[model samples]
Each structure stands twice: as C-alpha cells, then as structure tokens.
Target: MRRKDSHDGPARGQGGGTGGSGVTAVTGGGETGGVTAATLPVFLFPSELLFFSEQRRCHRRVLTLYNPYSFTLDYKMLCTSPSLYRVLEAEGSVRAKSCVDLVVRHLNVSPANCGRRDRFRLEVRGGGQRGGREVWAELRGGEEGGGEGEEEEERKRRKPGGHQQRGLQLPLVPTAVRPSVSQWLLCVLLALLCAAVLMLPLHTDSGSMVPRCLHVSTNQKLACAYTLGLLTMVFLR
Candidate 1:
C-alpha cells in the first residue's frame, strides 16, 4: 500500500533588520488533505493469492471485488509479470452494492518457476476519486521431488516380472433396452392379430361380418387376454 498527500504552500517569514533592511525565509510545511490507500472503501476477498502447480498444469483462481457504496465503481487490474499470467475481465464496472469476480490464471506453471512471487494492483475510481491496493501472488509446489516420485512409480510399473494388482473389470450394461424398428413392427402385428381375435363375435345369433369359424371360443379368448397382457408389459418396459 502507498500513501499520497497534498500540501497547501511553503512557509514564509519576514524579519526586520537594522537600517530598514528586510530578510525573508521560506520553510517546508506540514501535509494537508492527504488520502492513503487504506482509506479507500474497496473490499477484496483473499487479499493474497496462492497457486499450486503440482496439482494441475494450469492453475486458476478467482478474485472477488465488492462495492458497498451507493454509486457504481470502476476497477482495473495490473500485474507485475504480465507475460506469465492471464486475467479474465481485468477491467469492469461494479454496480452499487454488488460484487464482481475476476479470474486469474497462471499460464506458465512448471517446476522451473516454482515458489515465484508477484504483485498485482487493483485500481478503483468512483465519485471523482481514485485509489488502489496491492495484492501478492505466490506459486508453490511443482518441485523436483514430485517429478522424482512419479518417475519411481513408473519404473516400478515397468519392471519385469513385477506383479501389479489390477482393479476388477466389469462389463457395462445399459440401463434401458429400447425396442428396434423390427421388434416394434412385430409388436404392432401381434397387437393387430390379438385385436382381430378379440373382436370376433362370440355368438352366431348376433349379426357380424366375420365368418362362423373365426368366432372366438372360451379357450381362444383366454389365450388372447394372456397375449394382450404380455404385450402391455413389453410396451411398459
């Protein structure tokens, strides 16, 4: 954080000397109307940022900026090492009583640059006034130890006659079995045949266009009912 101060003017004094001669001197004065970085009402979450490169190749972190004032606030982000990092939505306006999220990504994360430190500046302007705050960023992990451990495990796995336990392999089964086009057509034909058998007139006394031999009997009616029940189950399944 930095401090800024404003001064009115330099001190001036006049002294009377012998023979009507005058002597004047100027001196520094105290600071007045000064505004410090801490005086700003900007709110930032996780003032310090940390990235673990050993966890992933690309590391990303979110920085939140909150505006509690009644008026909107404009903000901009500045990085000390611009080439090694990327910022999403680096500059934006935050509405009154709202917050905005900025994504910071470490583009170059490797073992060579571990434990690196950088600084970021968040400058805010609102209500004809400007202020800024500094944030520290550090990259950790991704050391030679992690790489050596991975290499040791690989060597063990590649060793000859070294038995490595394998996980149980299970065949994947589908949750639901769908009927194909041919199966659906077969079902429709079976439904039509069942409907025709059930629609046949049971009594010869009743006038029906169907022939006498096609009339449904008691046993045939039971078989048709069973077939219809089976078709219903198949459709529901």
Candidate 2:
C-alpha cells in the first residue's frame, strides 16, 4: 500500500533486502504469498510427530488450525496407519478468520514397531467447497518416557537417605580370607555362644538356681553378659 525506491533481493543477514515486495524469512526459510493466504489453513505442530514417551497409555497432542479465509473451513485429519493412532477431535469446522483445536493422540506403539516414521494428513476445504487443500505432517521417533513407578523408582535412587545405598558388596580379598566364609563361621559360633549364655543360671547369694539353668559363679555370670552384648551388636550391624 506504499511506494519505495526498493526492490526485494537475495536476503543476507540483515534488513528487509531490496525489493518492491516486502520480504520476511520464515524460521526454516520460506516466503509467504499474500495471494495464497486466503486459501491456506495455518496449522501448528511438532516438526517430528514421533513419540518417545510411555508415561501414559495415550499421548495427547493439540493441533491448532487457523482459517485464513473469510468463510468457514471444514477439515479432517487422517493418517496412513489409523490403527496406530487416534484423533480425540478428528474433524471440526473453524469460523472465518478464526482458529480451532484438534487433538492428535499418539497411541502406544509396540517397542518393536517404534522408531519408524510416518505421516498424517490434514485436509481442508473452503467456502464454495469446490476445491481443497491437503498437508501432511511427517513425524519421527523421539526419546520415550518411562512407565509408572519407573521414574519414581529411579528418583528414589537419587534421593538422599535411601535403600539404594544398602547394597552389600563382597570384599575383594583373597579366597582364603573370603568374607562370606568368615561371616558364616562367625555366625555359627555366635549362635552357639548365645544358646550357652541363655542356659547359664543367674547366681544368687543363697546359691539357688532354676532347674532349667546350670548355676554359674559370679565371674562366669559377667562373661555371659559380655557375650550377649557382643552378639547383639554383631547382628545389628
């Protein structure tokens, strides 16, 4: 709507180049045609439709479709492998110059069937419905998310004060001095010691003892108590 001494040219790293036509470069590089805007539908989505997440049974993705026309537009989404995916709101009508939402749900793909890329088509028809426009989005596989309890269990390992730190690793000592053998022997000895300690009778000033327990001298009584204390400590460790 204005005149200038300019002409659009090969755009370098700078100003609106030199051209009669106002020039703007898209993110990935493209030129928009004013003539085509009236017939085109604007759609937004991920560059790669591949899903790597498994946190839910279905991956919900929202597709925003805008109608640039002066009249309402009717559109439907379809995919080559319809069985592998679902559209929560597959078809819808958008008011003139307004936008509507379409949800493209990515169903769970089998592990073996994953990582394969596919395309889904969006078909749109304008006012007179005499002609139409079709665009396909290509989706590639992305990193997957974990299932339930999987992420939580991993977080537990990273959190402080955990069962994760309770792992028991055997000593790398020589076979002759292997810790397992030593522990087994020690456990057996400790068991016997505890039984013996329990059977010892408490010494009384009158030299009386229960029939189930043998009477022990005062010195022996002290030794029995020491043994019991040591056994408790070992088991706790």
RMSD of each candidate relative to the true structure: 16.5, 20.0
Structural similarity to truth (TM-score) of each candidate: 0.45, 0.39
lDDT of 2 by residue, 8-118 (tens): 321121111222121121121122211123345345443345355443433555566655567666655545566666664455555665665555566655566555654
Off by over 4 Å in 2: 1-41, 129-237
Give per-residue lDDT, candidate 2, residue 40.
Answer: 58
Model 1 C-alpha lDDT per residue in residues 109-191, reported as the tens digit of each score: 87777888877777688877777666678888752354445667788777877788656679998787788999999998998
Cα lDDT listed for each candidate: 0.65, 0.50
TM-score of candidate 1 to 2 decimals: 0.45
lDDT of prediction 2: 0.50
Candidate 1, which segments miss by more than 4 Å at Cα?
1-39, 142-237
